[model samples]
Target: MSAVAESTAAFSAAASRELGEGTNDTPAIAALRSEAVALSSKKAWPDSRKERPWKYHNIATLDLGRYTPGMSASNGAAAGVRSCPVTGEHAAAIVLENSDVIFSEASPDGLDLIAFSALIDGRLQKLVDERLGSAVAAGTSKLTALHYAFLAGGVLVATAPNSEFKEPVRIVRNYSGGGQFAAPHTLIVTGANSRVHVVEECRSDEGDIVVMPAVEVLPGPGSVVRHTVVHRWGTNTKVYTEQRMVSERDSEFVSLQIVAGGGVVKGHLESSLVARGSSSELYGVTLGTGNQHADFFTTQDHVGPDTRSDLLFKSALRGHARSVYYGMTRVGLGARNADANQENRNLLLSDTARADSDPVLEILTSDVIRVSHGATAGPVDEEQLYYLQTRGIPYEAAEALLVRAFAGQVLDRVADEALRDELSAVLDARWDSPE
Candidate 1:
């Protein structure tokens, strides 16, 4: 077998061994496990050479055999990791370490918070079965299939009908221990006429580890959902994440993504408006330094009439870092009067830094109201730099200032002032300007 195939088999063998120890393998989980095993047993990696989506992000070169399943430490806590920045002062928190739930809080009145295993065994089993893997179909990719097959502890949150939370629900996941793999999932369901906000923060201590996570959001008719995600893995880590949100009639969904760390990071985000008058807004920002590689893929799918979507993604790369962004807006035949727009922009801070952006729109209905997409990858604006320099700022500081301003456009759009300020501080610490 080739090296990739060999590594695949090794990872699968390790996962199977870990599955033997998990305590919450319900019938639904059992079915998923069987499907995942069948697909992964093929020992085939994603075909980057033939697939357009995989072309920019290549994982075939990595040796998966080097990493084993992440096991809970004897201490039962994530050591050397900082406490969750999002405290209970503003939101309830769920803490996970190595895919194990270490701490969690009950949601405020009018909402139910449970574990994924409990969700499957309770009255919501049908709902979970119907929507669990719908957004990210299993067996489509090697890692995805493996994730489902070896799924561990995850959070399940549901809001009651017409209920509105005063604060966001926060989930803080910290990954530690070197040479291990952690896969966690999150599912959020909003009832009719309900409103909620959620924030997910992911980080890792120093380790050469792999963290793969998936999140799915289902909004009922006339519901509103706002979610924010921040990922700052250690420099020795690689991250692969899949996130999707599906909106029903007259619902609104918004997502903000900020990525700043990891040696190799790949993320896929999708939002679908499946009923009339549904709308979605997606905003993302990425900052890369050192030799980091960051890749993001996004899709805005409109399947019903009078639906709308807007997307904006920005990136800044320095040193030998590289970034890639692929965005698409698809309007189905029944999506008459649908309005969709997408834009991607990147800034290179050094000669060796690289960026690639692809934005496309697929309009199947001629009766659509409006649709457009655009992308730009270029160096920092010389004029902006010169202006800052003329104000007595050093060249390096000037460049950093310009880069910060460029990234702040998306940051300023965040609704929570506290969360916005916290992210801004992190940006200051992570943003690297060429010396």
Candidate 2:
């Protein structure tokens, strides 16, 4: 095996010892993996594509049964995202721990929560099942297929129409691996005229393993939904994350992603405006030091009239780290007067560190209001350093200050002071004294 693969196997072995002993010993996880095996062997699947002239399509399918052991829990975290949670609540809180219903709090009254697996149990899984393989399939790509074939956690939340949030809802899952695989799924659905914010965080404890995440969201007219996610699994893990959302008339959706720690992170975020007057916003930030590598890709699909979208992604790299950001916004032919923008900014802290960004736009509308995208990469501003040191600040502190500033644009949007400060410290800790 290649050195990278060998190291991944070592991590997975340690994770197996601590997170899970084996699938046979974990019934819930075994069942989840069995489902994945079934999904991977299916052959009647059709090619994925955009149905309309303005719809954006950039789907990559992979086979899941081909999963290989990795140095960390990135794979498990990514797979965990594929499973849906089954909390018994009415407003549908995302569940963790394999068919375990942990959230018993009084769900916001008038809201409805549906478990994806329950659909498999009750025979209503069809309408959605039809849309599942198409959203982010595992047909040929191991990254995606493994998520579909081996879901261990997932959630579907449908809130009341025209309601507002008194507090942000939070969902979190922590994994301490023991040779076991886990999937945590989450789904958000907002009623017409509703407004609310949601957050999801995942942390793995002490073991290097595999993880997956599969999320689906739907927002109705005049409704608003905000989302934020943070994934931190030690240095020897693998993770796959998938997110797909549909917005109806007058609805708005916003998402933020942070990957401050992991071995290899592959994430996909895709949003489609199903009706006119809808808007979608996708944002992300990542930090990688050491031998870490992360890939983030997103797409904004405009299917309705006058829809709008905006996306910004930023990353900071040090050590022997590597990262990639690929994003695009497409305006359908019938979706005129659409306003869309994309931006990707990267920071490299070491000469051997690497960062790559691809920001693309596809416009099918002739009378669109506006469309633009750009990417930039440069070393720390020498002028800023000179100004700081000349003012009596030490060189190392000045450089650290500037590096922290480079990451601030992302840090500012975290919305939670504790998380913001925590991420800042993670960035600050990576700088070395330049004597």
Candidate 3:
């Protein structure tokens, strides 16, 4: 039997026990158990059921006993690595490693950096606690249930009312001790009219395998939250992320995700604009070399009048790598003058590399201004390559340069020049020739 089959059976059994008894019995969770079992054994297409390349990536294989109930030592280590990519500043922060709250701090005034436990004691804790389970409950999936069972600590960030943080608050998370599973919890609440930028970086330590399950962001009225996530995990890790952003009236949310790590990563990202004049911008770029894999799904929900949203995602896969994206836009009733757009484009570098792009839109009312989604997947442009090659550049160099230019379009859109440059370098490294 293939590794997925063998691992799936084991994973299903462990997951069933959690889901079966979780939340006083969750039928939906039970359904996932049943689906997982069949998924392990079933094949969508006959004669070709490729074994998942990284059998060691699963997070459940870790020794749960090693992680104590509170923030572990690694939390401090993660905090120590806290950095500001934009302004080149350092921060007083907390860290979570291997789903364990390995390091924590309670330094007030500079920037509200508190662990989840402390936030629970603070005034704003209720907002996070209340909504925590509303969207991604334990019953939603077995993986999250496992996270619930193993989680020890979480990062709690609060942007004080109209408080403009000069240097961005950074919540840095890392993964070490492979063969370990981690459920990381983090929540950010911005006070009204406040503006703050955040950098959430995820890295992994050297080990056999790892699993990461995470969740939500809350941006309030008139608040502007610019959030960036850097995923540079060990090549032997598998990560599952579930995140959502809800924007209130006159608020703005900007999100950027980079997936240059992980052997197998799957997740969903969504934004819901619930008030008038609120806006959201979502962008992502994924790089997969060798047989690495990354899968992402995003949704833009325009529920209020005059809400605007724009989303763009680009992926470049080489070697035997693969990347897939599914995006959707939903316009609700009474959402007048709502404007939204989503676009997905992919570049496949090798014959074995693969990508799937799908974009969809759902409209509930006819009075809306506009909404549309588009997706495209293809290899390098022959014409562009031929033209460059004819100009005296070698075929390899020409292709490389063109490929960089294709991915550059997304980088140029980033507000942070440093970040844009960093992403550009990663892209060039992933593709031997940018063309």
Candidate 4:
């Protein structure tokens, strides 16, 4: 067998040994895991030379055989991880450490927050069974297949029809220990006419760890769903994240990703407007320092008539950091009157810092209202820095201010003031001390 296949087999064997140890695994779940392992065995690892999305990152250097699947954390093992609320007030909150739930608050009425492992025995079993893997399938990529094969702890968030959650639902995940692989998944299903917001935060202790996190959102007709994820992994952690959303007729979906930590991070964020009148808004912010690397691929797919989407991603790099962004806005042949826009901006703070950005648009229909994209990467404007310095601000301080303002453009678009403030604070903290 090839090296990739051998690694897959070894990891699969390790996963199988601890497969249903601490959680309920129904036959369906077991079958899904087995199928994922089988699919992984046939897939080759991504080659940077051959794949556009993998071009900036060297995936061959990562040895999957060196890391074993993480098990559930023992009681009190999460003492160092706190479950503080990011948005001040929340309808529900769950704290996960090493892919194990250590603390969880009761969900509000009309909202069901159940562990993915408990789905088979819970009241929302049927709903989860139908929608669990609908938005992001395991066969989407080789890494995704591995994610499902060793899937350990996950959560399912389901909303009742016509319900509204004034407060956001929060999830905080913390990872520690060395040479371990962690997979955390979240499946969200919204009912028709429902409105909800979800906030997820990720942190890890200083260690060599691999994390594959996936989130899939399915918005029902006329529903409004918002999601935000913050990455604050340790400097030694390698992270790969996948998040996708599918909007139904007249539904709206909004998502934001904040990447500030990790040794090397790569991921895909995608939104599909599958029904008429559906809309989506996507935003991302990345702050890289040290030798950190962050790479992302995003897609805005308009598959139905009168669908709309807008995306903005920004990155600030310092030290020897690097950032890469590839985005595509596609209007299907049947998507009449579709409107889409995409933008990516990068700021290089140091001479050695690097940024690569590509924005593409593909429109099949001539009846589209609008389709546009823009991308830019460069160093801090000397004129702006001089202006700030002339006002008695130190050069370094002025540069920092400019960088914050550059990233603040996207943060200003957040709908919730409280959440926006919290994220702004996080940005400042990460910028001031990016170690």
Tell me each candidate's TM-score: 0.91, 0.74, 0.77, 0.94
lDDT of 3 by residue, 1-435 (tens): 465564453344465354334322233324433554344333221121232322223434534333322223343544443343223443445566544444555544635766554443535555555555454555444455554444434566777777776555667676666555556666677889887777777877656554545556777789988877878777777777777788889999988887777787777788888889999898888877877888777889899999999998888778887887777789999778899999998888789998877787889988877788888888889999999888999987886787678778877776766656765776666565332
The clash count for each model shown is: 0, 74, 17, 0
lDDT score, residue 192, model 3?
90
Give me the candidate number with maximum lDDT.
4
Show model 4 residue runs off by greater than 4 Å. 1-10, 78-87
Ranking according to lDDT, highest score first: 4, 1, 3, 2
Better of 3 and 4 by TM-score: 4
Lowest lDDT 10-mer window, candidate 4? Answer: 78-87
lDDT of 1 by residue, 360-393 (tens): 8888889987898888888989888898888899
44-99 in candidate 4: lDDT tens per residue? Answer: 88898998889899787888877767555756764644545344778888878787
Best by TM-score: 4
Show model 3 residue runs off by greater than 4 Å.
1-92, 99-110, 117-121, 124-131, 206-208, 426-435
- Give the Å shift of residue 248 in candidate 1: 1.0
Rank candidates, TM-score, best first: 4, 1, 3, 2
Those runs of model 1 whose alpha carbons end farther than 4 Å from true positions after fitting are 1-23, 78-88, 117-121, 124-130, 432-435
Select the stronger candidate by TM-score from 1 and 4: 4
lDDT values of the candidates? Answer: 0.79, 0.64, 0.67, 0.85
